[model samples]
Target chain A: MASTIRVRATSNGDITEVQALIQHPMDSGFVKDSKGELIPAHFIQELKFEYNGKDVFVADWGPAVSKDPYVKFSFKGAKKGDDLKISWVDNKGASDTTTAKIS
Target chain B: MTTITGPLATRRLILQGAASVALIGLGNLPFAAQPARAAANDKYPEEAFKQKSEADAIKALYGKTAEPSDKVKLDAPEIAENGGVVPIAVTTTLDKVTSISFFVAENPNALAASYKIPDGTVPSVSNRLKMAKTTNVVAIVEADGKLYSATKEVKVTVGGCGG
Candidate 1:
C-alpha cells in the first residue's frame, strides 16, 4: 500500500530536534472473532530511520501495537532545513518509505 | 405364493432418510454461520467505549479535576482521510514520565488505550487508533509524580467499523 509520512521540528534553538510520524496498521493477530476465532496478528516487525544516510532510530514492534502506527523521536545537530528519511516494513511483507525536511 | 409385498415399506424408508438429511442440514446452518458473526462481533474494546466529550474522557482517565499541562505534547493529523487508522504520538519532556495513554472522546468507551513507560526508555509512544468518526484525541502523560495532557482534533474520512 502507498504510505505517507510527515516530519515536524520544534526547537528551543538550543536543540533543533525533529519528530516523524508514519501511517500504517500494525495489526496484531490476537483479536478474536465472536465465534472465538483468532484474527491472525499482523504488525510492523521492524522500522529503520536514517538522517542524511546515517542510521538514527530503530524499533521492534508487535501485535499489542495499535493500528496505523505513529513513531516520534528526537535527534540532535539537525538545522532548520535538513532531510529526515524513514522507512518501515510490516509482517505482512508490505513496506513504505518517505522523507521530510526540517522547516 | 403372494406376490412380493408392495414397495410401500421401502419407499417409506427412502422418504425417512431424505427427511433426516434435510433436518440435519437445517440444524447445522446456525452453527456454521456463528463463527463469522462472532468474528464480526469481536471489535476492539474501544469500539464499545462510549464517545465522551474531550473533557469527560480526561476526567475519566485522570480524575474529577484533571487539568492540562505543558509537559505533554500530543501530535496527530489535523484531518484524517480514513477513520480506520489514525496515527497518534505522545511525548513528554517531563523529567519522570511514568506512563502515557490515548483516549477517544467520541468512542463508545472512555479509555481507548494505555501504555507503561519502561525505565531507561524515552517517555514517548506512537500508534494508530480506530476512530468511528470525527472526534477529539486526548493524550495523558503521568510525569514527575503528576498527570498532564494535550489534545488534537482528528477528522476521520472513512468509518472504520465497516461503515
Candidate 2:
C-alpha cells in the first residue's frame, strides 16, 4: 500500500504547532476482495512523536480508525528552524519517520 | 517551481506514497488497504458500514427490524459549496439515547462516524463530514433499547479533492 505523510511545523518564537496528514486505507482487515474472498486485517497499532528528546504525543489505534489519518497538535517553548521528529508503526511491523523544521 | 513529467512524475507519487505507508508502521503481515467492516448484528463486521439506499443505512445503524421515529432530528445545511467539510448535527428529543451515529449512503464506506452518548451529556452532537456527492445523511439514535432515526439531504455544489 502507498500513501503520503506531510508534517508542517510553525513557530512564533514561543509556541510550536505541528500538523500531520498520512494517507492510508486503514483497512481493518475484515472485508473480502473483489472475488468475495476475505481480506486479511491490518492497521496502525501505535504512534509516537518526540521533540528535543521529550515525548509529545503517543497514540494506540485499532481498525476502527479512518483513512488518510490527519493530526494537529501544538507545544510551547520552541523557535523557528527547530527540528521535530515523528514516527509510526503499523500492525504489520512497518515503520517510517520524517522530520520538519519550524518555519 | 519544479516540473515533474511523464513516468517520473508517477514514480515520484508512488515512492512518496510508499514512504507514507511505511511511516504508518503497520504490523508484521502484509498491508491490507480495505476499509474496516461493520460489527456483528450490524452488517459486514470487518468492513465499513454501507447501505445500498437511504433506508438500508438507517436500518444498519438502528437495526434491521427497527422503525423510524420523529424523536431523532438531523440538522444539515440547505446547501454547501464544499462536500469535504459539511457541518451536521444530530439531536434526539427522546428521554435517553445511549449512542448516536451518522451515516453517508453514497460514500465508499457508508458508516461515516459514530459517537457514544454518555448519560446526562445532552442528546446532541455536531461535526463536519465529507460527502462524496449530494447524498442523504442519516442520524440513528439508540434509546432505551430501541433505535430511531431521521435524515436530511444537503446539496453539495463542489465535491472534495477526490470527488
Candidate 3:
C-alpha cells in the first residue's frame, strides 16, 4: 500500500520537531448522502509516533475528529538524521506505517 | 501630569498580594503525584469515548471536573463553513502538561480525541474535528495533576454527523 502519512522533522538545538498529515476520510456515521442514507462510521482510532523504535507520542481519536488529521509535536534528545515513524489504525481494522528522517 | 500615587500604590499592593496567593497555591500542589499517575500506564477511556453526553464523557475520562483557564488556548474558527472538516488547535503554557483532549459538546459522542504528551515535548496539538451541529468545542489540558480547559463555540453551516 502507498504511504498515507506525510511527515517533516527538523532539529532546533536539542529538540526535534515532527509534523505529520494523514490522509483519511474520518467519517462520523451521522452524515447522510444525497440519497438520504446514513454513512457508516470510519475513522482512525489510534495514531502512534515513535522515535528510534521508542514510543514518543500517541493519540486516540474518535469519529468526531476531522478528516485528514494533522499533528505536530516536539521532543528532546533527537538529532538530525534520526528515524521517526508514524502508524495509525482505523475503526475498520485497516492500518498503515510510514517512516521519515529528521532533517 | 497628574499624580495619583495614593490610589495607585494601594492598587499595586493589592495586585501584589493576589499574585503571591496564587503562587502559594501552586507551590502547595502535590507535584510528585503527577509523575506517579502518568507512570501507571493509563489506557484510553473507551467508555468515555462511547458516551453521548459531554458531562458523562468528561467524568469517565478525568473522573473529576475541569476549571476554565486562560492559560489554555483553543484556536478554532468562529464559523466552520464545512462541518465535515473543522480545524481546531490547542496549546497550553502550563508546566508539566501530560495530556490534551478535545470534546465536541453536541456531537453524538462528545469526546473527539485525546493526546498523551510525553515529558519534554511541547504542549500543543492540532486536529480537524467533525461538528454535528453548532456547539461549544472544548480543549482540556491535564497538567501537574490538575485539569484546565478552554472552550469556543463553533458554528457549523452544514451538519457533519450523518443524519
Local accuracy by lDDT, each model: 0.60, 0.61, 0.84
| lDDT of candidate 3 over B1-163, digit per residue (tens) | 2378888988999999999999988885543112223212556556678777777677667777799999999999999989878999998889999888999999989999988888777898877888888999999999998899999999999977756
Instruction: Name the docking class for model 2.
Output: incorrect
For the second chain, the TM-scores of the candidates in order are: 0.62, 0.64, 0.74
Interface RMSD, all models, one decimal each? 7.3, 9.6, 1.5
lDDT of residue A14 for candidate 2: 70
How do the residues A16-86 of candidate 3 rate in per-residue lDDT, one tens digit apiece? 88888999988778777799888788899889998877778889898888778887778888888888888
Query: Residue by residue across A1-103, what tens digits does model 2's lDDT show?
Result: 3435688888776766666776656664545678877667565555555678765544344443445565554566667877887777776888777777789
Ranking by DockQ: 3, 1, 2
lDDT winner: 3
Clashes of each: 23, 23, 7
Query: Which scores better on lDDT, 1 or 3?
Result: 3
Q: Against the true two-chain complex, what DockQ does each candidate achieve?
A: 0.15, 0.03, 0.47
The prediction achieving the highest DockQ against the true structure is: 3
Note the chain A TM-score of all models in turn: 0.79, 0.86, 0.95
RMSD of each: 12.9, 17.3, 17.7
